[model samples]
Target: MSSTANTTYTTFTGWVDPPTDIRPPLTENFTCSVAVIGGGLAGMATALRLAERGVDTVLLESDFCGHGAGSRNAGQLASAPGGDIQLLNLLYRKGMPAIIRLTENAAGHVESMIEKLGIDCDYEAVGNVFAAVSRGQLGRTRRIAKILRRAGAHVEEGTARELGIPHGFLGGMREIKGGIMNPGKLLRGLRSAVLASTVRVFEQSKVVDIVRGNGGVTVETPGGVILAQKVVLATNAYAGEWDITPKRLSSPMWVTEVETEPISPQRLAALGWTSRSGLITQHNIMENYRLTARNTIVFGVRQIERAASYPLPERHPDPAVVADLAKAFARRFPPLADVAIDRTWGGWIGITSTWLPVAGTVGDDVYYSLACNGHGLAQATYVGTLIADRIATGITPDDLRTIWVDEPKFGHAVPMIMGRLGLRAAWTADRFNDMINGSKRHAREGFATAAGGFTAPA
Candidate 1:
């Protein structure tokens, strides 16, 4: 059967080129002990885990590795694993340790995978700076630093003035282990590692349907089919049309990133940003800034609502996103007021309502793994490994396995309808809330509700 669905998602920084290829379609009915769906980081990790166990498995991709959000993302290698403890404590109540391990290690796992497989994805561990753009954000960052310290993660206190910063910040939080990376190279390395294994990896073989028979499950694709006793679904934003879509806890959110032509090393030194570190302003609507290996200045923040207001223009990047990016860059880096923007790209990020990962067996033969809440670059891989391990060992504990699989208010058919609408309202409301000194809080909270959940604490 042929199906026509407006099911495509777009990204801003990543529409440039496709990843190196592997092989071709299945071209025949094949059977394995397990079948994994979606070829992004999560899917790749799941398949790699299964393969490591010497389990017979088949991995399916709608497009190619990293072709989706996997490859198109701004590669932020988070070292300290896990979510905000306060929010996790609220959502999980007494349940925290296991989920933290699964989500937080995702950041570390990125580095581990790169080292283990010798994949050169520009893995660096220079550290990340989380600063407050206002008094409210200052308090929040301080509290966040306390939480990380209590959790035993390495952290430090740094003031914007001491750090020689921009945007006129009061103070900041520092996480030294977090680093920068080339997202596409990371995904490419994983794909190469998976393909080199005995595990079967197939591309351009989009799954059309899934069936659970008396014996096992079967994943049907246009070119071929995969029959297995178990299956894993790792498609994040693109998995919306499936029965498992509701399993995601947060709503679909969009983000955009822009890269500038390399500023001379001398220019960077003069700007006080030559140090190997990334920075984020904890404003109402947060903004992140980083210096790339090539000395280019990159910045990312909330832009999904704006992108929805304007789809992928026939032109490379919608002028709105480009223009807004230019404005944001100038505001953050007044010294680089004359910098040239090389390119801009955007990608969709999945979030969960509970502000935690949602992973568990949907049916007996099928399992779900998704919603890292913009932390998928690491969390997804960590969650994917846990899911694969549990499935392999058949150890599905209620506390760990059953905690998040059912979190609510996630997945979107086309979020521009409501999500983008909420963003606009929040932007308007935030400006008004500023008079009462609650502008940042109100705006962040607004976007959280627009996302159908409370935004995770800073």
Candidate 2:
């Protein structure tokens, strides 16, 4: 590995501190109607739903619940369909309504969950924007808006200034249903709700093997064995680690994020970001930016790292990658260029070849839900609920049936070398655009250029 690749940095998620009340791991063989693996958002949601239905459910987590991507993500509860919307429109043509409904309902479901469960996660219904940093990207954003509108999604197009985005973004498409939140708090809230339910939850319980039997499934962890009549694999990225999981179900991609020290309210106001909406750039590997309740700005993920093997080892954010993120942050918001980054953190996320969130059954008893791509914050929780309902009632709802696949066949995984080359190529293209637009340099005192390189009101 290159020196840059070998360098490591400590994990420091800026959302919130880990919860103090940790559940004990299972020490004896146990039986349950449903066993959900991986205590992230999906698992917690699944176990909570099953328990609410009076089904015997147990949840197992390698670490504390929400320690994974649940708390590690940028916390944008995006309502717009992820991945390439145009491509998805062409591919899943007749299923567009379901796709639109899924995205919209995902956001609504999360909102209802918070209200019903009385969980406070600083959620804002301010909506999210697919912003553009260049003229090329602005055009692309318009195309995306058209695609989304055609699919019956509610979207509006506007310039950065009109949208109250302080950065030098040209323009963007705004999805009306979703906003931002403290993911750590949200995850902890879900954890608390799940804990209050009758479901038995075990932390620090990593599953080593899964064996299918005549009527039930056996999940073996380091501490004990769990005999479950039905199993829901909410493992996401880690699903590929098990031999029983479908081959090439999803690729594990690691994404990094960093947060800055709190900015003064006056200074924040001067930037014209009054709407407090989250922003996502139009790069191939999109970069996300959002303001936290603490007044700190968090952003990252212009690039992604792929795991080389399954059973991914415990890894930290790379210092070099963190530095790259810092540079990107500075380039985007030049007025806040001097703000100090508090810390950088990252975690694994699953991405599918089709770039669509998928939920399906592996066999008669093993149900798997993986590959939310990058929109798992709302989709994961919603899908988990649907999966639980399906298992409980034996009748798949229309929403659940829309994303289900009988055979879990996927396209071949991209060769490692080719994937790296493609990433480099994409990065090169972004840099080329930056150079062409002179965006590498900080904007003037109070002016920034808009699309077509015209000076715009800030």
Candidate 3:
């Protein structure tokens, strides 16, 4: 919190846009022990960890840091994956212990990094609300909380009355250790720490090809090339991997988030986040949100139609889409429901077929880590740590084989079948669910009742 540190933290790297400023571009080829591609949370974390190991590292990013999903997101620092406990434990049975440890570890990693590097980002570790928007989901969420607690996790249930929200939520679980954040600021802090070390980072550096050899791996780029003993593809949506296998393990996904002008303190207090961690639920296509320091709400939802057909929009959040989402948000928080949304944006992230992060080396020398599924803030920090550990200890990660196992990813054969149709269907379905369920008279098990229909309000 020193003035010097604040000046450095707010040093404003490039453009002072809503997203964090861009770091300088990587213009020339360089040699290092590790080369991290992509400048988001994953890339920065990997580069920082590599530097900590005293390994020469260079990070290449197509755009400036934080411009990607890491900064473009709504800044909710959640600890859990986006699936049910049964599904996660079943698929990652071997890695279950690691997964549990990871949930807690990710929260710790954020705290530790802020302390060690003097990061001034507004990092708060409040609990997250796994809210149940419907009665059926309430039962399901309670079961999930029990399993998580049995597995040594911390999650408890709360009702709408307890949280001071509407009665739509029959009941939901609250993860005390979960939290929210300013993702752009967090990424900025990491980038500063990265710049301070021997680790070199190149912005505007796009890798074109990847070649592995006995000595190390080489990543070819436009202006230059990166030669290193090991390479990590922290790139998510744009994996930048020429190897067909790594490409198959990942697909691009898009999601939208909106931020309103800071709400009044009284209005914020009404939302009932004693610690202000974040809010989410157990619904299959649920919405998780958080209260930022400025009192703006950062809300997000998953995009359907699968990741395979997810098209990268040339623009930010679509106009009508943002307006509808903003309106739905206002309906949820009546006090500031009318608050004008200062910003509306969308981002592309990688989602594996199973919707879990796939991190592990493809071959001996070529290391690939990606498909974060929105847990990049936490998972990327850990994966970066893993990459560094692998490089330092010289260990083959056979134990993590299942976690990174690549199955062929297939998209719909219809040519761009889902551009506006699918988005309208999902966005409308979710918002309509919220609205219809928002009414007490109609709010039974919204998702399971005859009203479980996900159609938007006509």
Candidate 1 lDDT over residue span 1-458, tens digit each: 11112112234244236765646877899789988888888999999988998889899887676666677666776644333445655555444455444544566777788899998877678667776655666787787777666655666887664654543345577676657777878888888888988778888888877877858887888888778889988887656546544532445556677777778888787765534567766544556777776677667653454333212222233456566667666655657777877667676666554556577666677887776666778778877877888878887544346344543444542233236566667455534443444455468768998999855221
Error of 2 at 98 (Å): 1.5
| Best first by lDDT, ranked | 2, 1, 3
| lDDT of each residue in 271-316, candidate 3, tens digit only | 5555455767554455666777776676656443344432344445
Give the per-residue lDDT of model 2 (tens digit) for 1-458: 11122222456366888888888888999788999999988899999999999999999998899988889899999998787777788888788888988988989999899889988899999899998887778898999888788878888999877887875677688898989999999999999999889989999899999999956899999889999999999989899888888887678888888877778988888877877889999887788999889988888888888888877877778787777877787777777877777777888888876667889987879999887888999999999999999999999988888889889777664334227677778777877777766643336322444333645432
Weakest ten-residue segment in model 1 by summed lDDT: 1-10
Q: The CA-based lDDT of model 1 is what?
A: 0.66
Off by over 4 Å in 2: 1-9, 413-418, 439-454
Write the number of the candidate with greater lDDT, choosing between 1 and 2. Answer: 2
Q: What C-alpha lDDT, on a 0 to 100 scale, does residue 375 get in candidate 1?
A: 70
RMSD of each: 9.1, 3.8, 7.5
Which pairs clash inside model 3?
25-203, 26-203, 126-277, 330-337
The TM-score, computed over Cα atoms with residue i paired to residue i, of candidate 3 is 0.82
